[model samples]
Target: MKLTLTLVTIALSINAVFAQKTNPNYDPELATELKADDYGMKTYVFVILKTGTNESKDEELINSSFAGHMANIKRLVEENKLIVAGPMLKNEKNYRGIFILNVSTIKEAELLLQSDPAILEKFLEPELFLWYGSAALSEYLEASDKIWKTKY
Candidate 1:
């Protein structure tokens, strides 16, 4: 009888432990902001930045285009339309930069790219694709601020 009672107590304790991990009291606002799907993910637009024709080759034009490129990225980030943007370390295949837009449609992403001066000047080109990623990416932005001191 004592063994049966001890076993029952241990089983209840184990069940309680698992319950806390599985059933969390989540915030509704955050769930919506993340756009959590059934699997806690959503769609995004992924863009691959590549070297353009480089027809001009003029140093001034290149510099100006790059300046505009950075500014465009900043603008997208500020607007919350772009979630991730960065450059690759290697110049392989003329790969330059990348962007993950917080958009669901390719048409929307294309329009956003059109506003970039680099694209306008043909100094940088983009290859757009669709991506499915964690919706929490948006929420992590706030958490990231705690780890990084600089903005941008």
Candidate 2:
């Protein structure tokens, strides 16, 4: 009987040790605002901007389209729709850049991409996928704005 009680006690102790505990730093308000799950993560659309078939050598068109693209990026960021956007270095895949959009569906992301002049002009093509990442990812933009000396 003593051995049985000791074994049960050991089993209960092990279960307690392995049980999930609530995060000490968890912020319910922030999590709710961000639409985060219990793990503090939410869904986003990840876009890979690739070089498109529009290889026109027209410098004027290229310049104008790219300028509009940059402007579109700023506008989306201001609207809190685009959480991340940046160019990638030269690669074999012809990937030009990436954008992590703060949107839930691929259709929504496609609609937002339609606003980009680069995509409209066929200078860049987007391949989108649903991404699961930390809800606080957008918060980085606050500090990012302070650190950039030159406006892109």
Number of colliding residue pairs in each model: 0, 0
Return the TM-score for each candidate structure.
Answer: 0.76, 0.95
Model 1 Cα lDDT, one tens digit per residue, 15-129: 8888635326666677687787755689999999888876897898888888998998889988999898888878758888899999999999999999898888998889999
For candidate 2, the C-alpha RMSD (Å) to the true structure equals 1.2
How do the residues 44-92 of candidate 2 rate in per-residue lDDT, one tens digit apiece?
Answer: 9999999999989999999999999999999999999999999999999
* Ten-residue stretch with the least lDDT total in model 2: 143-152
TM-score of candidate 2 versus the correct structure, residues matched by position:
0.95
lDDT of each: 0.85, 0.97
Clashing pairs in 1: none
